[model samples]
Target chain A: MKKKILVIGAGSDVAQALSRLRAERGHILWLTARSQEALQPLLADLKVRYQVEALGFVYDAELHSAEDLMAQLPGIPDEVHVAMGYLGNPDRLDDPKDAARILKVNFSAAVLLMNAVMHAMIEKQVKGVLVGISSVAGERGRKSNFLYGAAKAGFSTYLDGLRNAGFSHGIHVMTVKPGFIRSKMTAGLPLPGPLTASPQQVASAIIKGMKKGRGTVYVLPVWSLIMLLIRNIPDVVFKRLNL
Target chain B: MGTPMSALTKISNWGNYPRIEADVRPWPLQTESPQIARGMGRCYGDSALSTHIVDTRSLNHFLDFDAESGLLTVEAGLTFDEILQVCVPRGWFLPVTPGTRFVTAGGALASDVHGKNHHAEGSFSDHVRWFDLLTASGEICRCSRTENTELFYLTLGGMGLTGIIKALAFYLKPIETAYIRQHTLRCENLDETMAGLEAYGHWTNSVAWLDCMAGGRAFGRSILMLGESAKQSELTQAQSLNPLKVHSTKGIPFPIDMPSFTLNRFTVQAFNQVYFHKHPKGSRDSVVHYEPFYYPLDKVLGWNRIYGKRGFTQYQLVIPHADARKGLQEVLELLAKRKMSSFLTVLKIFGEQSENYLRFPKAGFTLTLDFGISASLWPFLNELDGVVERYGGRLYLTKDVRMNPDFFRRTYPMAQEFMEKIKALDPTGKFQSLQSQRLGIHA
Candidate 1:
């Protein structure tokens, strides 16, 4: 069945790929972002290049719950994708207001919006799927970016519980733990190709994981084995070595 | 029909085995209700709380047996007892036997049960060849890893929520006799148990019983048991025979539900001490009966009755193998500090990756404890749930009755896929259970 889909972070590279994949799959799509006007050229190109039913809505995960965003829509789409994430500089989060702002936008707001959409799908018992973009840094806290890690950790755990809550119901929850992504999220960071995934690779992997009913997935399957090795590093050595 | 909820009908535990203060009335069977499977009643909670619990005891009939291939086909309701009745006599046995034999074939498949040998053979789901599932639409479809693979995976450890299992076919393990060649190793503490079991896993089917009540120096101390089926030649002339099954004759019914204070620490400690001592020294070599070895608790017809009218709960959790020793220490330390004495506590080693993302048993160390019901228990269990979450571990749904939605989700991340598959099958959600509702599985 061709689904009426909505991409929440339309301009993001991952979001664009997801939009492309769904569009190619013949889904009727409505893409949303912080600047629909900014995304107009991309939107027009998408309609022309992908030939998908496409449109765009402006959204700020900081300001609006997904339901409010969807409420603005002509009607609800079959599935919603939250491709928004911020690996903000933890060092700059020293100011109390700054830290709280990061927490609100990065963690609280995203959770609220995603959950609102989840509540609707679950209550309607609709055959809907919700995918949250999370990072492997959320697996365990690190001194480098514990704040961002904490936010992703909370979001990842929320997605996990949401999955369990929707089990007997029709709702589906997925926790995507991409090891390292080459996107605005990690633009200039020097990352080894073997350890990192491109935005397109991540989007494809996430779709595959959701289709397989995988509860938790590492974007690069190799991360499963890699994480296994990291998880077993004993505390004595782990405490001394800084990753 | 809903279990008649009378003020008199106070239930604290979900196991068919009894504790102190309660009476277990069999749930009335209804034909019109969707097809159903019966669990061992060991589900400590509500995984088996279905509208129509097909009291699998009636379906305990073996349909066919291939002696050479060790493949046995039987009615879904067949229990481990019936399998042993036929297989033990003919040098064959079910590939995997969970802690208790009281569970039915459908029950085992529904829960995707794991046993002491899980590290070696995976779970019961791995051995199952195929099954006849009675879907909500009333279609009897054959599913296995090959046919209807999705249904097969979903049904395995699917918690009987997917469909009513009618009959199942699985390969059996060839056994020399009904006896097991046992080995006993005493670990001074939990870490040693992990090390000892891992070192010996390749050579044996293993399990351990921890001394949860023992505090301080003895905290996390346990006895590790590693064994494989004994060869037929290992049985002596006296052990070579079979005895007629004698049903428990005495019905020691709890005339009246006892007060909650009845199963206090004093009585529980006494029971724990006796249970711990009964295992004898470090180890002993003897030809033990399959009934005693596999299903000792089943001998007591109404064992759960001992817990009184207010039932108890079984809290089981699995920590990643790397952190098992530390996690087990924390759990035991907490239980000891609480002074909660449980009579039955079992520990098993798990290897191989957990297949079902949301299903409970995985590659790690799993701890199972039977605790008497107390008002403080839920809060305490919730606290333990937090501990499990920190370690990225989860509780077994089959044994869980009190985990909240957040805790449950943190525990089983793959629940979404199972949810989707089930939704695809039953859109209207006609097949519903109290557990699915309580855990928000069908909210």
Candidate 2:
């Protein structure tokens, strides 16, 4: 049976990649991004290339309340994927406005958007999955991107709590932690080739996590071990090294 | 939830030149219309390039088939290789295909690609029955020769500006064997090669490997290959093992981009010299799998990287039969005079005319010259475009990158009508590719 999946940020390459794999097996997709003008071509392309029903909406997650955004969707999605993230230039955090903007987009906006989806699923008694794509950077606080990492850490903790709450309600919550993906976010960075995974590789893990009903997942299973090693380091020792 | 995980990265087509920083999103199976469709990025130029591209490689799927009627329905993203994998085992094959099977159905239809057997089998446009096109307005318009007839013509080689093709149904050629019986002839000079090609024009499939480096009286030395689909009785022992199975060549990838100087004129000239001498004035008849017969270059996986990081451009032009000899002579002379050498040189004859607008073939002889991308390539190609324009021929859009609007309009007689048709389908002018923008097609 095809699952009615709603992708909150269809413009993201990870969401697009995940949908590409699932839709081929007859998954129904509902796409909502910041702009229909930008995501519409993707919907049209998917409909043509996969011959699947891909509906897209111009949804501004930051601007609209979750309930208002829910009104735009047709029904309670069987699966909801919140794959939106924001990382402001680390060097440009001189102004308080930049800090607020990043926090609003990354943390507050995501919670508002997913809360509406959670309420709708509970109302409809939908027994399905809620997936969120976080980053492995959230595992530890580093000076280079500690703020963005803090926001993701907060979201990961929120998902862990959501997983506990959803377990009693017949809903599953999965938090995806992708490390050093070769995406637009890390396009030009001189990251180690062996350590980096492509969006497709990350997307595949997300799907696996959903199917297995796992609470949290690292994109490449190897990243899980790497994160474990990083997490066990004492703060006194970890703070000395620039990550 | 909104996903902002899209990463912008630099990607290029097969030529590996003109790499651009593009926001490559995965193909959203369900969403609004994407700006452009990019298949395997097999096109040698900017024709398939876009800053914001919907990757079509993931959409690849073989949907339906009818062995009795030889009708195959496939998603636009399905590659020729996938199609052949299924159909060849069922005694069916694509009626028309390009030199490489890596191309997706949508890419082939968009370019109206032709094969070595073009004189007999024609182009992809001729074999297609109909296709489901997702327009800019997000409507799935069923297009065919009889239905939505206007768009049908324009979309055939329309460069995909009409819409994103969703699915297409086409007729396939049924075969009893997967082998092609070929007869090879070695020609001593330009006149002999042309004469040999003419003699084999009626063969089911034929092509020539010309040594463009040959100068003076020894010019146009070539090996002319002529073939016909092997009958059941003519199948070789290896082919009969699994008559319908598709054969795959062992691929050794070019691990890294070769240095630009690796394939310079001196190297190409020497290579051509060796190739020219390899085959003397003789003939050989052999039976082989259809894969190698149609897609010889496919044997060399990632061979384009041999041209180095700048990539290469394939300049293909077809001139009227009347001017073929002189035009070819001039083309070769220009290359030799400028010391511009081509690593891969091909010559063939096109038959009849296509009803579809923007189709490149006519009753003429065609030549393909492959030049590794270099700093001086544009000016050299511009002069060659002048040569083509003077002789009344046009470039293949599939491999073109630098042709100007004036030359395009002059060479293709149906440019105005084609533009009008594209505008009719795309009234809001939504779809635009790098090639269309460069040629001022949208304006």
Candidate 3:
């Protein structure tokens, strides 16, 4: 059976990978972004390449309520990929508007959409899967970008709780904690090979993970091991270390 | 009636994994509460981890006994010590005993645990005459091969997923004494070791302790050990002296976690080499204590701390009888490459088809190894899971800590069948555990 997948925040690189992978699966896809024009070329290329149903829509995730936006969807897609994120600068968050914008965009927006999707899922009474892109930064706070880290942390915790709720209901919620992905999100930063992943790698992982129904995964796979070591760092010495 | 307190459920072997947090309520103590059955806390993992534990340890009450018929009835929580305490003195023994005696009558049937003698005796399920189960709706169910056969099969190796076993009626074997006439052979490699095992194919009880430390030329080197109760004619003056007077001090408990690096290649290699050479290679008549003979590791309490706070996981998988040889070779090779040394590695030959399709041991070769949690262990286990799947084998859920849901479903094709039965009995999915929730078993 063919699947119809909807990708939110389709202008981002991770969104590009999500759209491309779903297109390859020959799925019916609806890619959404702030401006339909920004997503048009990719949607056209996807339709031409995979020959599946493809379309683009302009939707601002931060401004719209999930129920209102969900009603606008052509139909409930086979799967929903939420890739919206805001890796805003933590050091320059003096402005109340900037801080709240980041919080609403990264945390509030995704939760709203998830809540609506979950209700739709329960009503439909069908087994479904959801994947959210979280960051290793969310695992624990570091000095580098904790504002972004804290937001991912909150989002990841929310997803965890959601997964617990959906588990018995046959709906799977996965939280993908990518350690360091070389996307627009981390273009200039130096990343170790084993600890880092590419957008394509992350996309492949998500696709494989969803098919496997794995509820949680570390994109690089090695991060679980690295994180194990990090978790054991004694508080006495951990507080003194300079990262 | 309202849902039973979340605290009142009992869980079994397949239920503990990923280490999640939850409230486990004890079984109700009221007169109306259903009678409980306690199993050996070691159904490998969670098979016995539940609320309302029968504490079979106290139920050690013995009922009717027919010495000539080898049929006996005992409470569900009785320990092997208590059983052996009473029965062995009367020249009678359990028909089937798994590796560990720490198990109870309820657990043995719940897991349908097999032993070195599996090829001959099948499993504990095959020995059970009948049992009493406390169903979810608060009913006492008497099930057996002739009665509620479906429930009977479901409870056997059913992981206690069916209902709580309250008591068991099983047949016992007549033995002369507690001593076992034993033999041991040292095999050079995996092939030689399996060859030694197959040579003793008809022995009453047989198992092999492998030296996983040996790699390449000598990997899977092991001591092929076989034994059975000594005949009256074979007992010497000293051996027949006193059967019930066995004595040994309990093992000292570990006070603190060992350093993670304490078990590096050098340390483990030395231990394995020393242990391998210490056991003499000859047929000898020696009176051995049951604890050392069977539960040797049980001597060291709190052994998990040996891996430090990061406990180790035992990855036990069995390749089908057809691909047993080649598959085990590749698996051991992978473990060597990963340098994941276990405290103890074991190899056993199982019997023909088991009653429980999803059960771990089958008509094949089973290998178990303890692995300390490492940064590289997940990917390594994932790779091993793939290999096991390709060979039409599955990881034992009791010991699994890393296998994902997809891998689990593929390996156990009969899973849907098992799940169907469970849902009918537990439509609301009231009883749950970390492993069941993680692997989607409850659904």
Best model per DockQ: 2
Cα error, residue B251 of model 1, in Å, equals: 10
- Per-residue lDDT for B1-443 in model 1, tens only? 00122212223325532322222222223345442355455567766555444444444445566777887777676677656654665667778887667678888888778887889988888888989887877788899878988888788888877777877889998766777777777776667767877888885588888777766665666788777777767777777664222223244444554565767677766666676677665666666656666666666656676666666778888888877777877777777777666667788877775555457777888888877666787777877777777777888877777778767765787787778778889776655555776777676
Best model number under TM-score: 2
lDDT agreement with native, every candidate: 0.71, 0.81, 0.71
Q: Give candidate 1's iRMS in Å, 1 decimal.
A: 28.7
Q: Which candidate is the best by lDDT?
A: 2
lDDT of 1: 0.71
Docking class of 2: incorrect
Q: What share of the true interface contacts does each candidate keep?
A: 0.00, 0.00, 0.00
Model 1 bad stretches (over 4 Å): A1-243, B1-13, B16-36, B39-42, B51-58, B241-262, B274-282
Predicted structure 2: lDDT: 0.81
Give the better candidate number (1 or 3) by TM-score.
Answer: 3
In model 2, the runs with Cα more than 4 Å from the true position are A1-221, A233-243, B1-7, B28-34
Structural similarity to truth (TM-score) of each candidate: 0.58, 0.72, 0.59
